[model samples]
Target: MYRMYDVVIVGGGPSGATLARLIDQSKSVLIIEKTDEKSISKLCGGLIAPDAQRMLGKFGLFLPKKVLVDPQMFYVESYDLETKNKQRYQRFYLNINRKDFDNWLLKLVDRNVSISRNTKYLSHEYSGDSITIQIEKNGKRDFVESKILVGADGSQSQVRRKTFNDFRYITKYISIQSEIVGGVILPCYEVYFDRGLTDFYGWTIPKNGTNIIGIALQGKDAREKYERYLKNVLGNNFQEVSRRSTVIIRPRRLNDHKTDKDNRVFLIGEAAGFISPSSAEGLSYAFRSAEALAASINSGKNTGKDYRKRSLRIKFNLFMKNIKSIFMYTKFLRNLIFKLGIRKL
Candidate 1:
């Protein structure tokens, strides 16, 4: 007989973990994570925006001293390659190690919530009113039945592939990041705008005592473009200590969360393509979407309807982001905006 669970969430990242924490303890929740351990480094800039902090605060989560680096005032520095103009602004944001942050979130889950590390969700099938998921661990396979199935896997979500099978639902972009140790310390984070690089942007974020630099783009020669931009910035002093790559999901549908009503399958986080189109910041969306999902399940409402209603603000903001991206990428226009002594971006 297959083990039964009230809710089975695939992927134990922020969205899955947050969802598990928000769900009532009366419900049996199982989080299956492919990683063998909780201390895996995710390819991210590790910058936590104020909105994400606010959401975490609602859940009584504060960045522990061990997990948070020294509180350094954030500064936004943008360089315009077209006119060789630089603009800087004072901003506020916190940085934390993603590996540490994720582990901390996992620990916050209700003790009753079952967590299975090193387990992979192979596939799923719907029968009657329940869903049966095929999972693997240690060269062995098992099946778990759940009333509701949630997919929080990631950009290349297997759950998404199995359910939607639609390639155009969400657009994917390639992102590469490198951690540079023993580099020149900067008091503020920096962003570079170069048409020669990615269509989006490149960033340099200071975390702890090291610098993390990355570029995200939709082009085939993303790495080649990144290298050219790096050469322009470092002038030969660039030395990467470690490198990682990941895909960023850009969901075409900002208003509706993907759900299979008959199959009881739901998607949140990157699996649902909940990510910022401009900044590529996902922590806020992950937490918000998970909260919405939890609320929908708890209220026993139409999950898709609740999710869409709850995400209204996010959808509007994303549309604005799309508008901002247009002017932000233009050479002369961006330089003019920066020269106007306005660095709010």
Candidate 2:
């Protein structure tokens, strides 16, 4: 007899792990993760914003010392590369090693929730009340049945793409990051905005003894622009430790913040387009969406309807973020704000 799980989550990151941790214990759950234990590195700046910190506190969780990195930042230095204007803003962000942070979250998941490491989610088909998913592992294909399928995957989520054929609702960017070991660490996080380089932005974050420089680019010559910025910033005196790249998403419309489809499939975190357009922060959204979905499941209600209702606040927040992005991304407004030292510390 074939066994069926109550829920099967793709991508064992923050959203998947948090859902597994919070879902009803009686319900059988399985998480499919592509990355193995030996090599776990997420392409992220690894900064925990105040919103994420509050969400952690609500979960009664505390960041272990081992997960934290050096140079805890209390300010952000913003620069408009085109205008050559700079300003400092007061903000507190806890720096952390993203891999360690993910590992920590995974460790907190309930033992009853099965985690399949190095497994990739290929596709899924709905039949009757359950969905049959095809997963790949070590050159082998296997099928699993679940009453509900959750796509906690990242921006390039297969589940999301297969479910929602429309891609025009959200904007996507390629984020490239490099860690330099010998660069001088800045006292605070540095943000750069240059329309020539990227419509999004670039940042330099200090972690441990290394400086992490990353940029989000949408069009051609992304690597070239990133390298030029790297050379201009580091001045040929730094050793390149490692380079990482991944897809990042920003919701273009309120409709883009989708939580469910057909009352059987669901999405959370960046997969659902809950990331902040202004700041690109998704940790808080990941945690909150997971909680909302878990609540929906544990309520024993129509999970899809409940999740959609619970996610309205998140969508509203994203809407506000989009409005804020207008101010941040508009060159004239940004330059004026910087020149006037508005909110500067």
Candidate 3:
């Protein structure tokens, strides 16, 4: 059957949910989520700062205090790539459980939102103006037709596969993260880096009784490096990791002055390269980008051109990428970081 919608978002993560909420115009919306139910295990450490909050606040969403482990500080740890100088940098930021935070945001979205979980996107045929997406679930198949298609899916996004040019991005770093059993975590996001970590860092986020610890490493030696890091972190007495997960983040989205190109499709969040370079964060940016898209559509503006070209967001993103590339490209900036530093300047 052909279920028509004004907008059809392929992933029900933060960006998709936020987009559905932001578009105040009454239009049929469908969210196709591949993750089963409310069990989307988040691979992030869940940290937000003033800039992130400021962005989300524009859409009537901001960090809620109930979910915060610590609502006021971000910790950055630096290890001299050459000399092992352990420096910790602290910046005021809000912290929450990624799983909890995303879930909370989803619940706050308008009740008109209809989301189908565990539904995989099979394929989509674009008529050069509109889109028809085929999805399968529970041994049955259905089709969705929409005026606009949004790829809010993460790094391995299927929507990106359909809309992408033949360009392969700098698919950077490999992360191994999990919830820890017993540890005293500070009230901040601690970042640790050194030659052992190469182009990445290890992190420990506090959540009262438990701790969230992980590292981002690269190359074929990543598994060995991660194991070694865990040993060093736990003093070799730690038992098996509780739940290990991985994610591949882009270094920065370089080619686009504006991220999307087609009128029929748009990209937001990680799929759009909206992940912040300094902290590798996305939820707040996702909300911001989603809101930008909704606002453009509401004001009867052209999304593919007008908002893509004239919006302050696109300019800000390009600006952030330019400044952040320094961190992604070399260890030179690593030398300037203290064990504790601030988020801006």
Candidate 4:
């Protein structure tokens, strides 16, 4: 006979780890993580914005110096490649090593919460009152039973794909990032807008001694566009250290944010389309959604209904972000803002 856990969370990212940390200690919880500590480098810009800081404060968490990277940014330098327009906007961001940050969060989880590292969640089946999950680790397959299943996976969430299959209407972009060792370090974050390359945008963020050149694009020519931008920016002078790619979701409408299915299974973080459409920032959303879901579960009431109610504020926030994306992405409106020098420091 298999022991049934109170909760089984797939994907041990920020949302999953946070949920494990915040959920009722009496409940038996298991977290399935695909990557180990050494191989947990996620494809993210690693910039912690003010919203994420606020979430950390709420959790009574403090950042250690080991997680921070060098050359902290204080502002953003916006550029229009097509029009040659430039503007500097003040924005505070905490530069961090994403892998370290994620590992730190994982460490905060209670030792009682079983974390299966280097484990892959294959599928799940629901019976009368419990859900059975199939997972693989090091060529060995095993099964686990749970009263509740949570998909904290990510944009390409296996749990969400197997369960809800919702949020397909939300737009997805391919984000390509290349880390270069040799480049001129800028004091501010560099943002580039060129409609010819991509409908989204490109950016250059300076790390300790390296610089990350990244761009968001769609269609078959994504790599080609990213290569073009790399050539334009680095100009064959910098040594490319590494290249990473991932899918970024942009939720445009209110209906795109779906958090629960059937009161037993739930979604959180980017798996539930909680990312910002305008800024592509999801850390704060991840933290908030995980907290809300934990609260809903701990309440021991209608989990799904409570989760939906708790998520209304997040939905409203993303809705406002969608409205901002219009002014930020629309060519005419963006140019108008640039021309008028709105909010430029």
Best by lDDT: 4
Q: Model 1, 278: alpha-carbon shift in Å? A: 0.8
TM-score of 1: 0.93
lDDT of 1 by residue, 1-345 (tens): 888998999999999999999988888999999985545677888888877888888878778876776546577777876568988888777877778888888898989999999999999998777899999999899999999999999777788888887646566778888888644546576888877666678888877777888777778788787777666766577578888888876654543345444538888887777777777778888898899889888877876677668767766776777777777887877888977987665
- TM-score between candidate 4 and the true structure: 0.96
After superposing candidate 3 on the true structure, give the runs of residues whose Cα lies further than 4 Å from its correct spot. 62-66, 70-77, 165-167, 182-187, 256-258, 310-312, 318-322, 325-329, 337-344
* Cand. 3 Cα-lDDT: 0.70
TM-score of each: 0.93, 0.96, 0.87, 0.96
Which residue pairs come into collision in candidate 1? Answer: none
Worst 10 residues of 1 by lDDT: 254-263
lDDT of 1: 0.79
What's the candidate order when arranged by decreasing TM-score?
A: 4, 2, 1, 3
lDDT tens digits, residues 114-216, model 4? Answer: 9999999999988879998999999899999999999999888889889866646778899999888876648668988988998788889988878888999
Please give the TM-score that candidate 2 achieves against the real structure: 0.96
Candidate 1: count the clashes.
0
Residues forming the 10-long window of minimal summed lDDT in candidate 2: 336-345
lDDT string for model 2 (110-165, tens) is 99999999899999999888999999999899999999999999877888998996
lDDT of 3 by residue, 86-164 (tens): 6565556676666777777777778887888889887888764678998998869988898888888876677777777
Clashes of each: 0, 0, 9, 0
The TM-score of candidate 3 is 0.87
What pairs collide in candidate 2? none
Judge candidate 3 at residue 150 and give its lDDT: 83
